[model samples]
Target: MATARKYNVEAVFKGAPKKSDFKIVEETLPAIKDGEFLAEAIWLSVDPYMRLFVNSSNVGNTMFGEQVAKVIESKNENFKVGDYVAGMFGWRTKTISNGDQVRKLDRSVYTDDKLSTGLGILGMPGATAYIAFLSICAPKEGETLVVTGAAGVVGSAVGQIAKIKGCRVVGFAGSDEKVQYLKSLGFDEAINYKTMTSLKETLEKTCPKGIDMFFDNVGGEFYDTIIPQMNTSGRVAVVGCISQYNLENPEKGPRLNPSILAKELTIKGFVIYNHLPRWPEAFKAIGEWIEKGQLKYNETVTEGFDNMFDAFSGLFTGKNTGKAVVKA
Candidate 1:
């Protein structure tokens, strides 16, 4: 028998999530069945999507998330004991899984010290940046690409990949530190939106040729400002609306349909789960980029499982520079 400690949603979020919204519980696990494995979490991911998902989630359900865990005991032949795996096992210190949606971590790609990346640049965020940006934006050399929330796990990756594609990259982040981080990633222009006197004016000056492709993460005023400045036939990948995720009610924005129609913009919103089959393709490409020194990644890791809520809530406050993960 094993025991697991996990976080359960205690209340639905209002403006932003609070510690009182979750409660930690310990459960004694039953013995592993014929094809089950017991795993202890090594790293847990706290992402913006968790906040959005909580809106529709039932109270008392385990807080939704993904984690990298080690197989401590196994009855399944496919999953050996001591194997590391990444799975949607929630914010739990331990999990008993039958391997339905679990993937054994590729040792060749993730070494012992780098295993935490299984939740970051080499994992879901990497896949999202590679697959969604490439397929949706279809970036071309010499084109200008604008990324909002540009210092986040996915956004930072998107900027670098665009640079690798020879696109002129302009990125928007919240703080001066993040702007510098974006510049370090080789963004042609990094704007601190919080300090900009006029976002429209700064964007117009920075992207003189007009934005050719827009990878939007923060959707609100930034999205509104970028839409009217796009070149004709500009492509927009609506990856995330992080700005609106914490709102108790949806904030209305200026209607951009006129700008979209005038420019004949192509806009598509995507959820990464729909592209699951192509994840390996993304991982392979991103892994190679990392190996070649063409891509770099950072993680803002919180040290303890008890601090999961703090890490999760930090996404809205610009507290993380790259991927935000918790060591369990």
Candidate 2:
């Protein structure tokens, strides 16, 4: 029998997750059964959603995540040996899968054989940005757009895509490096939300025309600033409320109930899985943008699987400038 190493949750997260919440366990694998394939994880994604999911996830199950893996052996003809796959395979060294919730690697997006991107720009994050922004916000040329959490993979992609649409883009990040990184991605202005003495004053200066579209990734105090400043009929796409993810009790922030009606703003919240049928269209457009030099992406990769907890924890602290992943 073959054995695989896996990281399983030992405790349900109460507040912020700590290293003690997880455990590494070794397990034996049976021979490949019909319609199944064996894959070895090459890269694993450490994302903010897992933080929220952990609170309700099975305590003794493998940690929640996605990975890009190589199909080492296969009994399913659809999944050939040596083919690369992207799936929700969790934090494990190896996977035995029935081909459910898996996608074959798209060479156009993974150009030059960079499979790590399957978990970052070219995968879930990329699809989220492409479909959600274009569908919900419907960005127009010359509009002023504001993006919160602008340094993460989805937010960064949103900013760049807005730039491609000829929108004047402003971004907010937690650190000076991330602000500068957003600027490098052609954001018209990048503000450090943590260091800014007055977010209202900064917005007044940078967004003289008012925000025409808002791509919100972090909701909390930031939402208070953004909602009131939006132009009439502005569109707001709610992706993730990362700022409130780790809280044991979600904090109450400035009220936006009146502001939405006053500004006539259009706001909608979405999950990527809700738009799964559109992934092919999203991948085609994002890949074309990448090939045409219209899109750029970055990743803060941790070196080993043993350090996955560190990488996962970094998302809350703004330790990663873009997508945070573990090289397994």
Candidate 3:
């Protein structure tokens, strides 16, 4: 038997997550049996959706999330030793899996053979941005597109892709630092919603003509405000609503009743899992962009598996840039 460390929830989050809410417990793993493989965790991801999903996460159960792990030993011929894969393996240092659905990552994304990226840019968030922007937004040259939560993995990718498609890109973020980061990625305008003008005022000033597309990551009031600023026949990809994730009995934002009719908007709410069959398409496109200096990405790495709660808390307060990863 081998001892494995895992973080489990002791209590559900009340508002913002607290360190006292989680506990680290040691569990012994049985030897790998037939059709089973053992993987050691390399990196774990902290995402906004995880915050939203806890409404149903069983108290005292292992926290639910994804990770990049290397198959250390295997009885399954499909998952051989030294092969890296990503899966929804929860928060554990070692995983005993049947080698179900997992994808191999290209080391070109992050050299040193570290498997962290399978959880971040090269993983779910990357796929989310790719499918939604190209399939939903379908930005055209000179069309104006605005992205909310522009500093995170999906938002950053959305802005860059809009730029690649020759769309004029505008971004709204929580902090000035993130605003600067969005500008560096070639966004035409990056507005800090915290101190700057209201979303409607900023939209009026920055994109006076009206928005042709919107890649929405922060919903609630932000969504309500953005709806009226859209041009006729505009498209919106509602990827995630991170702003409302942490609130206790969250209040609804402004009503979007008249704006949808007025703007004739196409709002599509989606999950990236539906586009897994087309991942290679997205991977190839994003890979080329990274190779050609067109797409810029950043990861905020927090070292130590013991600090998972701290890393997760960072996402709620906009403490990270681009993608947030925890190095085990």
Candidate with top TM-score is 1
TM-score of each: 0.99, 0.97, 0.96
lDDT string for model 2 (192-222, tens) is: 9889999889999999999999999998877
For model 2, the superposed segments whose C-alpha errors exceed 4 Å read 108-113
Q: Candidate 1 residues 1-328, lDDT tens each? A: 8999999889998998999999999989999999999999999999999888885455888888899999999999999999999999999999999999998998977899899999999889889999989999999999999999899999999999999999999999999999999989899999998889998899889999999999999999988888999999999999999999987788888889999999999999989999999999999888899899999999999999999999998999999999999998
Point to the candidate with the largest lDDT.
1
> Tens digit of lDDT per residue, candidate 3, span 1-328?
6678998888878888888878899999999999999998988888888777775455788888899888898999988898877889888899899977866555556565435657766788998899889999988899999999999999999999999999999999888888888988999999999998566778999997799998999888878888888899999999988888877897867778688888788999998888789887887788789889999899999999998888899998888998999998
Clashing pairs for predicted structure model 1, backbone only: none
Give the Cα RMSD of candidate 3: 1.5
**TM-score quality measure for candidate 1:** 0.99
**Number of clashing pairs, model 2?**
0
Better of 1 and 2 by TM-score: 1
**Which RMSD values do the candidates have, in order?**
0.8, 1.2, 1.5
